[model samples]
Target: MTTVKVKLTHKNYDVKIEKGLHQAIGEQVRSVWQPRKVVLITDSNVGPLYLSSAQGQLEKAGFEVLPVEVPAGEASKSLTKVGEIISQMAQAGFTRQDGVISLGGGMVGDLSGVVASLYMRGIAFIQIATSLTAQVDSSVGGKTAVNLGETKNIAGTFYQPDLVLVDSDYLDTLTDRDLVEGYGEVAKTSALEGQDFFNFTGKIRSVQDIRDHAPELSERSIAYKAKVVMGDEKEAGQRQFLNFGHTFGHAIELLSHGSLRHGEAVAIGMVTVTRVFEAEGISPEGLTQALIDRLQAVGLPISSDLVGTPLFFQHMINDKKNRGGVINMVALAQVGQPIIVPKPLDEIRSMI
Candidate 1:
């Protein structure tokens, strides 16, 4: 078991990553806070698979357990669902001392984190991430949010989790496509960090590689994010580098009308941004092609199926990252380096 500590301004926590670490959750929480009433928030798909085991463990530790399950999907990350979960927490007789445990993927982590953040002002929460995307990225940063309509993650807060428990065993139940979707983020992180990390992902040839090698990969991704979050916890500075491909990625997800997974769209977005950088004569030697090959090997799409420069440009304008009518983009000068460039719509349009 490897442990990484995230020290934020208002709070500090530890991210514990290992295979079969779920059983130790009760003991871990006890070490942080005295055993109090606990709430386990999960989605329908994950509820049957791992929820009961978590509940049983907490109950055995002498704490009352409340399990709340929402429908599984991106659609669940909404204001309405947030209200529903808050109401459920109240009905369960929760207190300020109780903590909420997010027991699924990113969706569960985001929504439940928000619930824990807002309930009775704020309560502690733990991330028991069961998916690759959540374990490596979403579960660590303290960025909790719900999607407002078509705009992704527009309504949210910076609520850090008290503990992040990742068990690679859960990846065994993930579909090939799901695993591929996660590799996109892992690849993007590798690209933003450097050749050593990028090359590590390049050698992966199967889903089992992701599971077998997750601890190291998870640690690397978490470490990269931790530095950014620690420096600019509020995203007012260098932290924006973490959104390397998300600007175009979020636009693509919006344009697809919710069909594309976040990481899949990000894969296409990274390729699009790199091509734009290449056209501008700013990309590094052999980097673009290598990144593209790595993404393809993991089954991520290199190009968008929907083609229309005008439509794509329109979607990019609506990104939350845009500031004062100018689109702020995080573009790569080379692997492991990201520079934020503000571009006019006409210039961005011409590239499409």
Candidate 2:
């Protein structure tokens, strides 16, 4: 078991990475935020597998657990779904004194966190990430959002969780494709962080390796994220490093008509960023090749199907990170060092 404490200005939380830690939820919640009621928000796919265990634990802690299961996939992150879940909480007599527990993957965490943030202004929430992507990245961050049409995360808020509980055992039930999708983010982090983290992930060749290793890889990735986030909690400075591959990734996801998974699009986005870096004479030694190789090794796409530079540039302009009509892209100066370049629309169009 490994623990990383994330200290926010208002409150501090712990990200507990361990195997079979799901069973300790009752005690952990009691020790941290003691609430009379807990609304466990999960997706349809994950509800059947682990919902009972979480509910039982909360029940044992004398909590009135209201299990709300939404349909799985990205589509669930919508205003309609969020409203439905809030209504469920209302019918269950939920109040600010109560807390919400997200027990699936990124979709659950993001959607549930939004509910926790908006319901009665704000309330406590816990993250029980069941997927590699959520455990490593999305679940730890305070950013929670839902999509609005073609734009990604257009409706959202910064709502931090009270606790982040990562259980590696859930990876056992993940499909190979989902596991591969997760590696895209892990590889992107490697590109931004350094080769040592890349080397650490190289040992993870298969889903079994991820599960068998338990909290080691998960804890390390979370720690890397925490370090970056602590320095720039609002993404005002060095924290933008986390978006190394996300600019192009988010566009690809929008352009693909939701055909590509977030991680898969990010994999393609990382490749595009590398190409742009090379064209700009800013390519790092062996970095581009290594990233390409690692992405391929993880079954992620190295290139995108969309080829029109004009359309791509248009999407980049609408990016949330854009400031004063200039897109701020996070590019690699070297492994472990990221440079934020304020790119003009014309320059960005030419690069695409």
Best-matching candidate per lDDT: 1
Q: Rate the local accuracy (lDDT) of all candidates.
A: 0.84, 0.84
Q: Please write out the lDDT profile of model 2 over residues 226-321, one tens digit for every residue.
A: 988777788788888888888989888778876888899999888888778866878776677777877776578888866345667678777888
TM-score of each: 0.96, 0.95
Off by over 4 Å in 1: 307-311
List, residue by residue over 23-103, the lDDT tens digit for candidate 1: 787787777867888889999989999889889888888778889999999899999998998888899888898988899
Clashing pairs in 2: none
Please report the TM-score between candidate 2 and the true structure. Answer: 0.95
Clashing pairs in 1: none
Against the hidden true structure, what lDDT does model 2 obtain? 0.84
